[model samples]
Target: MARNKREEILDVALEMFAAHGYRGTSLDTIAHRVGLTRQGVLHYFPRKENLLTAILQCREEVNREHLQAGHAHEDLPGQMAAIVAHDHQLSGLTRVYGVLLGESITHGHPAQEYFRKHYATVRERMSASFAERWGDRLPSGLTPQAAATALLALLDGMQQQWLLDHTQTDQPEIIRDVLTVLLGSPPVK
Candidate 1:
């Protein structure tokens, strides 16, 4: 589908933000990339933080859809493997998240609260789903919540490695190996 102006701006901004950290990319550059004026960009997003929020939300929606694609199975590690495979094709988006996540580590960064809330929501949803099928704790003795935290951390760490050297790091294989250890030797079918 052809993108509307706002969508076009967002697409360009996502790419730009992915290429450059949030602080490195400017609205003027984003506007120039999309053939818009500063005011035109502002018409959709009054602040850069707003644009960041919109971009994060869009990414979350897409990730949620990917995670849910295999929800019928009780195999969370499998679902996560699928998410890893999916993320490989969206490295730009992954870099955008990694950069912003690092910057958001500082207290009161604009994306700080959003990242905090996003993580809590993700952990809650993942744990809830896993708990329903696998019980509150995995065989590894980690609770579903703890497992979720570990899984997210693994993804972030692997993304950093992949972003640094994509040719050498196999993100999905690494994730799968870790998940096998955490979930079980055979990965629950």
Candidate 2:
């Protein structure tokens, strides 16, 4: 029950942090939503930053799980497309990701190191996937590393656009169209 409560608090924190940037969210707001006092919240998080760290850690763990499921080893393009589809449903987490990522690009942000290491790991794995799928080079004359970087940039750009106007943007279609260039066809579900 105690562990469940902590998870619950984290969920609320994730939602609040997504709706309002980290600096805009307070321990009071999270505690209030969770029906706990600020002191009670502190008993679990100790500090608001600690809670933020936990939220980010959770996100990394979930992403790691998805990667470890052999998705990258199998049909990478299909897996990547599936990831985009999955994100469509988790708009809140995506918003939190984009907002925090933009904020962390500046110097001295609390999440700077975390984001740095996280992207390095993501890029490494993605580059490997591209290499395994496309051999030494893609049609554009870019190496796997360059292509992986471009793909990441494309995904982020599309996500930001979709987040701004979901009704106007076809996130999954755009993602699939991009994958078509890599795989010769859009990845099937």
Candidate 3:
């Protein structure tokens, strides 16, 4: 029961945060949405900063799960497709993270550490994947870490574009094409 209540609170909080942003969202708004008193909400999250931390932890878990699942498959294209599909499924949270990450540039934001660690982990994982897939054929002057950083940057930029115009083009196809060129492989059609 306690776990369920916590999840309910987090869910309501995510919705409120996504809609109103961190500063714009209030504890009262979250409590009202979850049908809980302010004190009840406090029982789960003592402060609004605690709730923001929980939300970032939840997003990290979600990203780790998706990345692990994608990595389990040996086919790189299939893995990329899975990632794109997962992003489509969780676009709302993705947008929320993007907004918070941008805001976190300000000193002492609750999510600054979370975003920093998240980006570091993402870069490391992506670098390892790039090395595994293209280590042999990489140009003499190129390093896997550099390639990984570029790939992650590309994906972040592409996601921002897709979020702005979901129907302007097909994101997965665009990603597949760009990756194919980078990896010297044909499109995954």
- Show how many residue pairs clash in every candidate, following the order shown: 0, 0, 0
Listed in order, each prediction's TM-score against the native is 0.85, 0.82, 0.82
Q: Which residue pairs in model 3 clash with each other?
A: none
> Which residue ranges in model 3 land beyond 4 Å of their true spot?
67-71, 128-141, 185-189
Compared with the true structure, all predictions reach lDDT values of: 0.79, 0.77, 0.75
> Which candidate has the top score in TM-score?
1
**Which of the two, 1 or 2, has more TM-score?**
1
- lDDT tens digits by residue: candidate 2, 30-99: 9999999999999998988887788787766766676677566645455666677667777777778888
Span of 10 residues, lowest total lDDT, candidate 2: 180-189
**What global local distance difference test value does model 2 have?**
0.77
Question: How do all the candidates rank in terms of lDDT, highest first?
Answer: 1, 2, 3
Candidate number with greatest lDDT? 1
lDDT by residue (109-161, candidate 1, tens digit) is: 78999989988988898788668867967777778888888888888888788
The predictions' CA RMSDs to the true structure, in order, are 2.5, 3.0, 2.8
